[model samples]
Target: MSFVHFSVLKDECLQFLTENAPSNSYFADLTFGGGGHSFAIMDLDESYKLVGVDQDPDALKNGAKLIAEKQLGERVELLSSNFSKFPKLIKEKDPEIEFQGILMDLGVSSHQFDIPERGFSFKYDAPLDMRMNYEDDTIETAADICNTRDADELEEIFKTYGEERFARRIAEKIVEERPIASTKDLENIIFHCYPRNMRFGKIHPATRCFQALRIAVNEELGVLTEVLPQLVELLKTGGRLVVISFHSLEDRIVKRAFKELGGKDSPFRILTKKPVTPSKNEIAANSRSRSAKLRVIERI
Candidate 1:
């Protein structure tokens, strides 16, 4: 499948990040899934340069091809690394390099969700593997967590990460049905755990469980927590750090970190008092973007 992702809050991000930008400035797109935001920034000014980073090998390959196809090799540099490691990697490459803008569009890419083999969405009946970098065998797969984690651990993951009301019941059911190796297998287990009336509810019973498994498998929250502070420090004075989170957990972290960094003694100021949500038109065009919340903080 082709790499496709709608850059959430594209206009809002560009407006804030490039409002007072100078010539020959640098920017970073930490989660350059489809190069949507990165390419847009480059298109805004010929002197602007972008460092696009992504851990997914597929994204790196696609980004490289797109850069070459667009003949943007001189302006866009693609890196293969998780967003969490971008600060260290950039420092090693050029300690003096500071970005005018940095963006992180968190959560699984649309490509990842559409590809059934990747197992990110419950709609697919593939292996229950949700690692962002599937090539990294060291990372635990969703199947591993479902099959090995105790009911208590599973319950916590469902409750903390997914906020599922039936976390305990679902966790117990997962434990009862061991060796859940496929998405459908796990989905069935979760579906049966829900009340009969809710089986056909607006939301799928497997949605929260799948989300919880993906979060645990990828350590998404922990990575986000560790990267926010580092990203803020990498920004130049007046530079902006823009983060678009798809879930409340990720949004809360971004909100709290921005608030802490924007304290009176701190060197940052919150740009968006409240997060920017998708317009009704955008949400209607792309339902997946309905939950996206964009937050910005500027170094002072």
Candidate 2:
């Protein structure tokens, strides 16, 4: 069966990774969403070994099939774990292997958002589950956050992660209407929280709330911040690290991390001073690709 995926920025990512490869050096695709970048880079060069990491078990399962089908068994290694744990795992896998190219395409996959049962999309009437790993039984969920978190705490989540200006009012309304049990119910609460006149903005009113919940449910930003410096350290000198972020909050994290690592006195040099967005052609083909911002830096 064909994997349910259309890789974003295929040509662009391939160009950056391949061009920066250290004379056929090893590479790591940290997010490895669809194995598109891993497959492309592995296929482009014979000496390029690959490690593909993902938190979701199902994604790695699909990746296994994709790797075998592509006849990349000799070149690629798949890991079923969070990329935040990547440094320790990399050393565990093979002490001799050091990555020359690392790519992190952050944010939820198309598969996650498209499948209603996963409860990623607010427009879809799915269950409230948003766990990246079905096996990870710990951590608070969107439902728990909505129902259990105080109004002040919930408001801060919306403001920080979602950049929602009406965050405080939304949290107040959510507190009044407790136990938001479904995606639609949560969306409705956010929709009505805003006055009718103010609600009809360019994007849906619930957009930020959903994003905030997903980040919290997954602890995405925290994981990212923890791992950023580690990834820079793991890179070989002159090695390239590419990060693609889909939202402004994510972009900000990536931007700050890249800047700190790329400092002249630091271990790396900046490659993309400004983040790169998708071309008009790519954006036209995939609407979700529009918001993506790609940034790269090289270990000095």
Q: After superposition, how far is residue 110 of candidate 1 from its true place, in Å?
A: 0.9
| Cα shift from native, residue 285, model 2 (Å) | 1.2
Candidates in order, TM-scores: namely: 0.98, 0.94
Q: List clashing residue pairs in candidate 1.
A: none
Runs with alpha carbons beyond 4 Å of true place in candidate 2: 20-24
Error of 2 at 179 (Å): 1.6
Please provide, for model 2 over 1-300, each residue's C-alpha lDDT reduced to its tens digit, 9 standing for 90 to 100. 335667777787777767756666888998887887788887787878988999877788899998888888988989888998999888886776667888999988888787787788887997677787856778666887899989999999999888889999999988999878888988888999888997888999888889888998999999999998888777787788888888888888888987777776877888898888899999898888998899888877
Q: State residue 99's C-alpha deviation in candidate 1, in Å.
A: 0.7
Query: What are the Cα lDDT values of the candidates?
Result: 0.92, 0.84
**Candidate 2, position 207, lDDT:** 87
2-58 per-residue lDDT for model 1 (tens digits):
788888889999998899999998999999999999999999999999999998888
The lDDT of model 1 is 0.92
